[model samples]
Target: MSNEKITIAKRIAKELKDGDVVNLGIGLPTLVANYLPDDVDIVIHSENGILGVDAAPDKSLVDKDLVNAGGSHVSTKHGACFFDSSISFGIIRGGHVDVAVLGALQVDKNGNLASHKVPGKMIPGMGGAMDLATGAKRIIIATLHTNNGSPKILNELTLPVTAINVVKTIVTEKAVIEVTPEGLLLKEIAADTTVEEVQSLTEAPLIVSPDLKSFDVAA
Candidate 1:
């Protein structure tokens, strides 16, 4: 991973709290596990029926049968248990998860998320994103500020939305934004980016917080 992306993962990890049950989405969000605070105890939840999910194991310790919702190799923490999707979704829909860290294709000003599919592309479908977004106590999106030079954070989402008004915060390589009733709030700016640069790259208008944080890359 590039330093910018790794820095994004490290930033998101700080959002996790002790005793929290965090459900990590596929792709970039998966890296959050590697940077979690060592002093706290947090259980990782995988939709594929694994609880207490551990970081990716070293190749020597890889277990073919063990994996996360994304089908990537993973290890299990002590006391970890496995179950069927029924019980898994039940835990999600029953609101047992404290936070759902997701990656998004697009996030609009209103916090609508569109991550699962893109119009004509053949996708496995939305997976558990809909359930996690709706049921988790909090939702945080970890993604690049833009995609191939185009902004992913927008005033209006152009792709099919996975869920509406569910995202709580957006952690991008450039900034940290909070989704609120008023609008998308710029809570923090990247250490190397300026407010003008962030605004220029975003399609949505940002409400700069009075106590906005800067140099988040080192925080």
Candidate 2:
């Protein structure tokens, strides 16, 4: 898992396209902002009611009232707008967002995501996951392939679901998988990971790419 976090972050970042409206969920999903290419004109959305969000702010520039959904202070571009949560969800449910990057505790073979609550642990609320999961045109899940050395990409989710069949891609430290009609397809794997190793971690059957190749950080 060398540079595992960075690797996962970069993998999600690469999926962004120009002019895309994106909502980056708390935690790992937020890292995508730091990696957006200069040429891309993607706009960031914050469910707390901000649009055209900027990258992380410097400590000196942090504003108590200007924060992302994760509660971290964030800066905004010149044209960014602040609105009510109701309007924000309208934009989400109205299908205005082109993509949503989410972090999941578990994602099953069918693209069901469990991020709201993991049984047996009291935690923060689900936040905007429900709206973002079903509303966004595309859902990209950014997470570790496993937790506590156990696979999180499962045959069936153990926790309650946030969304069903909403995931378009799964980016992890070990591999990248896309949800296809046939099933989850193994698009790529980390340089040192083997197909057998990845297969062992995934509960769903993995279909290796015909030209299967190793994963690498974009230069």
What shift in Å separates residue 7 of candidate 2 from its native position after superposition? 0.5
The worst-scoring run of ten residues by lDDT in candidate 1 lies at 210-219
Best of the candidates, TM-score: 1
Off by over 4 Å in 2: none
Candidate 1 per-residue lDDT over residues 114-181, each given as its tens digit: 98888788476988999999899899999999998799999999999899999999999899999999
Q: Over the stretch 52-170, how does candidate 2's per-residue lDDT look in tens digits?
A: 99877888988889988878788999899999999999999999999999989899888888889966784667778988999999999999898967999988888998888898899
Structure candidate 2, residue pairs in collision: none
